[model samples]
Target chain A: MLEIFARLATLVVHDLIGLEAGTGLGDAAHFFVEDTLKILFLLAVLIYLIALVRASLNVERVRAFLAGKAQILGYLLGSTFGAVTPFCSCSSVPLFIGFASARIPVGVTMAFLITSPMINEVAVVLLWGLLGWELTLIYIAVGFLVGMLGGAFLDAIRAERYLQPFLAQAYQQGSAAAAGGGEAQRLTLRQRHDFARKEVGEIFGRVWKWVLIGVALGAALHGFVPDGWIEENLGAGHWWQVPAAVLVGIPLYTNITGVVPVMESLILKGLPIGTTLAFCMSTVAASFPEFVLLKQVMLWRLLAILFALLLVAFTLSGWLLNLVEPWLTTGAGAGG
Target chain B: MREIKVLGSGCAKCNNTAERIEAKASELGVEARVTKETSPEALMQYGVMSTPAVVVDGQLVHSGSMPEPGQIQEWLQ
Candidate 1:
């Protein structure tokens, strides 16, 4: 699909736009057009599918299920749902509000928030296209585990003690109100479709510019950045590369849409898989904005714990990938 | 004409809120212009920490989740 889109973009740029190949302008434009179209196309399709699944997941059903689940299971379910659910990136506020209002466990909600942005369908599609299916699957599995374990650990530590008092009070009131009217409303197919369509529109509206900017950066790096610079600085030889990638990634925030192309370029240029994955995961999962959003409901301590937990988890993931990359590449070449 | 803005990020509930507001305004035989704000900054500016919020004229009538149909009707009127 990406190849076809790349070809179409090439045809348009070379034939329609009349831009000659090998020039800086031609290369950048070609990269931009191709990358943007591929990302957008994947975004629309994946988000729609996720929306369909989410519609069936139904808020009331999820709340009811969580209310009855075991402690470990709740964290696992929260993060697993977060990975598959479509709303993690921009719509987290509402999910947070919903979970709080329903009086879902704070730790469980934290798990969901952590996994949602990290492993949504959009991120998976991009990873599959850009990095291949094996890595995408691996990312999904590992990312889900991170959320589950992270949430469980936090809960065990009684992290709830750290949430803002006002939020808990609000949650208590919210739960009281919701209890009186808590009923599942089955949505028709058309309603689900409309909901999905608008979700696509809303996300597209916010991130379209970032897609361009990210792709442009990727393209620029592809065309101009010295080939060995990334590899030599941050590639396989250095054991510190994974941690460094995580640290750098936190301060630099970009969604999978913006980060994936850059990831593709770096991979093609021999940047080590572990370092790259760590950076990608950190950029999407452990960033400052997510923590900032958490602050609305949590005191500094809980927010700090979440960040530390994610940073550690992501760093471990990076090292684990480093250890397994050779075995993975030798075995399957990561989805041929 | 009443200027009503649905402050949200284009999520499911936001779309529903926008539609209900439009429908309620129309049902009441009121002339109204409704706008959807999908920008995060703009939505947050209206204090919509949670989405599917309603801004009537320039004031925040509701924020953080969808309002009930009855509430929508009251706001529109």
Candidate 2:
């Protein structure tokens, strides 16, 4: 019995030492935890700052501005403004309600809603960071044009009647606030700070889980997915791959920030810029969550219009990306 | 005091709009009570189909756009 016990202990000790030398599991765990925590903290701080900035905005003035503009002009302006604003798809819904209630042209409101998520500052920054300046500029310009043209098309259809009944109620609330004649009060610096903190906490509290999940998936794909397979399957000149990628993106929902890392990895692996961009846009603009939220404000017909617009926009953007990929990649490789 | 409500489904934008309103109000030295209304029923009641709809003193002020800080300050004044 004593001899058997000694043999077993020796075997266990040898296996443990071998595993430690080969894997360094402890070190990897520590790194992962450290990196993830850093990301989480940064996200929190960003959320707080963004929230504070958003909180200071004047909704009534925007309403007044939109209300006074012509339909086509309103849409163009709204689209332009939306590109500068940082709201995501889900967050844009309230803005949609406000615009609709204010009796802003449906086309203009839709333009703003679409552009707000598709062509945000973060998206632009990430695109520039990962893809370079020309592609980033193209993305912004094309995205803005898509929003403007799409809104014009929808407006021609006179799609306003299709807004859900609740939108009217939302308008009523805005009017009620305006009616109260309390629009003259102001806030102090301390109050603004508290508001910013609370707003950031609340917003981040709800969406952080989704952000983390998206990041985790992106990280896994980045680390584990085979670069060779992606290049062969989805590389330029694959006619069917563009549509397939766009289709693949529709069901998946993630913020641009979460998608950026994966995009960076794919580009490194020789995936075409346009195709990857289409996929990213589809995921962000045509997400299931975004559609679900729209159900509250838009009827089926209106939703269909938005969906078709996204599909066409993404497809066109992808095609355009393919056209320039050769030149961009060559320039980048030579420069590097 | 004027009553205000920020309506949203708890997304980041909604939260941002809410905070903006608070900041704007504070900047203008407005003595208004601001609240966040996240319930679907309350949103529906206010005809808010989106998250982060701002209702000031029981009126709906903004719904879709994140208003500029100076503009919000103007509204508060």
Candidate 3:
């Protein structure tokens, strides 16, 4: 009995501090705990900042303006504007909520939401710098067209009816406040500065967790996933691979900046350009997290439409790449 | 003091709105304090739902799209 008690106590102490007394399990457990804790702490700080920003938004005036715009024009403008923005996935959600609360036509808002992550100046510059002018121009034109058309399609569906009851009510309240032209409150310079700080914090807070999760997932895949399998299975001549890659990508999200390096590495490792591009598009344009965030503002029906549009767009882009792969490689490879 | 807030998540449209507002303020020589608001909370408080929203004197003047520089200047006046 005395010997057993001593062994148990030793085991407990070892496990508690990840020392593994006499075994190697303690070291592995310690490493895992340390890495995970670090990630968790970083994510916590990031989310706190995002939440601070989100809490500070003024939704009423935005709702009033949305009520005034032409739905189609709004969608077109939203999509076009989304393409020019420099926002990452997390920052885009607050913007999405603002549109929804503002009562901007759902379809148009969807258009902006979709295009914002897909097309951007950074992505464009990177694509051009890494790929070439031809591919870059094509991506921009296609991305913009898809956003415009997708928004119009969603608008035609009258997708706004799907908002959660609570969000809808909040939107109404905001509109009402705007209509009353409530007493204008002015903020002093110091107040505005404070407001800005809080806002950045709030926005960052809400999104940091998602960003970390995404980064961790990406990092894990980067570290452990076998590129040869993806290359062999999804490479050219496989018609189904295009759609499959896009479908796989929709659930995954990452910024173009993070994805570009991985993509470059994959391409170098014999991964099909089309497969890699499809993956990139899916990660950015149709991310699951983006959908989850958009759900806060949009109804299910509109979200579905947005998803379908992205699916088709990304699939087509992948397929088209396969078609032109031979020519592009021949022309571009010589320079490389 | 006049307060102007540009709301968007540091995207191109948001930046454009900010630039336009600055240009408008400069052109009119309006004594308004111009600031960029990228927080979801601040944007929601103003009822702005789109990227690149322009709020003048705590009133949301534009949302969902970037207003032209000329139009922004007009709004400033």
Candidate 4:
């Protein structure tokens, strides 16, 4: 159905408008219209469905649940909760302090914080729609591992000692003085529907421009980059390429919404899958503004450690995935 | 007079919530002072995990989103 719409659009632009098929402008116009329609439709449906299923879930509940859990399980659950929770970066300071004051371990809170930016439902939906299930699953796994492992590492180093003095004291004193969350209320179907509809509006409103800008960039890359040029010059053969992509990603910032379309274009352009994913993940998760916000709760030492941890994780994942890329694509083709 | 504090990390929603409360207070002819507290310490003290939380006269009344206009009027009155 979506394909038919895209085709009709292409036909209108190509025949009714008199743009030739092979021209750069013509092809880009087709790519832009098709991608915009497909991505927006997918985003609205998937976000609403996901929101409906988890409408009862909120940060307060997540905090209460994660507080005082066992170490390993806490890390896993924290990362999982992070992915499912809809968190704005500005909430990081309050959320961080709230979790810390509740006596949740630094590592567990860090796990939630790390994964929250990298793997939200919107990110998952965009990845699945643009890159297919195999890559989406892999991206999720990588996000979890990065969060869990990073959290564990912070714990091993006793990262709590480096927190802002008040938080460190709060952690040490085991102050459950913070407001315990309200009891969970069962929601009617109507309430869930209302929540999901509002979610659709807010999330779509925030990301629609990102979709246009991202797809425009992708279409430009698709139409203009000579086929096979990237494969020949920037393929998996180069060891430094992965880290280079990650390094380039550090200064640039965009949410996963804006980066996924670019990821699709890069992969299709024959840039290695691992390299593309690494770059996009770094851009979304490891930007300066996020770190600055985190600085409210964390001292510089801990902040620096997190920065390095993310860079290393992205680079390593990039290399590992590139090594296994042919196998992955083959498996995806067969199964997905 | 009521002392209303909007707690958040200075996000746009926090500002908007403060504005709405202030507007509703005057419209209702209630003498209310609406303030934005951006400090993480203030939020931690209140135990607010989700933000744009509203504290009316030193008690948390609403949180997690911008207050509806009805909620604003109720708070003022």
- Which numbered prediction scores highest in lDDT against the true structure? 4
Give the winner by DockQ.
Answer: 4
Model 2 residue runs over 4 Å out of place are A1-54, A84-94, A128-132, A165-188, A329-336, B1-77
- Interface DockQ of each model: 0.18, 0.20, 0.19, 0.85
Q: Candidate 2 lDDT, tens digit per residue, A164-197?
A: 7666555444443332221433767777777778
Tens digits of lDDT, candidate 4, B6-76: 99988888998998888888888899888899887888777787889999999989888888998888777
- Whole-model lDDT values for every prediction: 0.74, 0.65, 0.60, 0.85
Q: Return the TM-score for chain B, candidate 3.
A: 0.84
Tens-digit per-residue lDDT, A1-336, candidate 4: 446646876777787887778887887777787778878888899889998998998888888888778999999999999998987788888888878888888999999988998999888877776678889899999999999999999999999999999889887876764446646879999999999999999888878998899989988987788888998999878999988899889767786788888888888878888898899999888778878888889999999898888889999999999989888753321211
* Candidate 4 off by > 4 Å: A177-179, A330-336
* Candidate that beats the other on lDDT, 1 or 3, i.e. the better one: 1
- lDDT value for candidate 2? 0.65
TM-score of 4: 0.95
- Interface root mean square deviation of every model, in Å? 6.4, 4.1, 5.3, 1.0
Clashing pairs in 1: none
Reference interface contacts recovered per candidate: 0.19, 0.31, 0.44, 0.88
Chain B TM-score of every predicted model: 0.89, 0.81, 0.84, 0.96
Candidate 1, which segments miss by more than 4 Å at Cα?
A14-28, A56-60, A88-94, A97-103, A168-183, A330-336, B1-50, B53-74
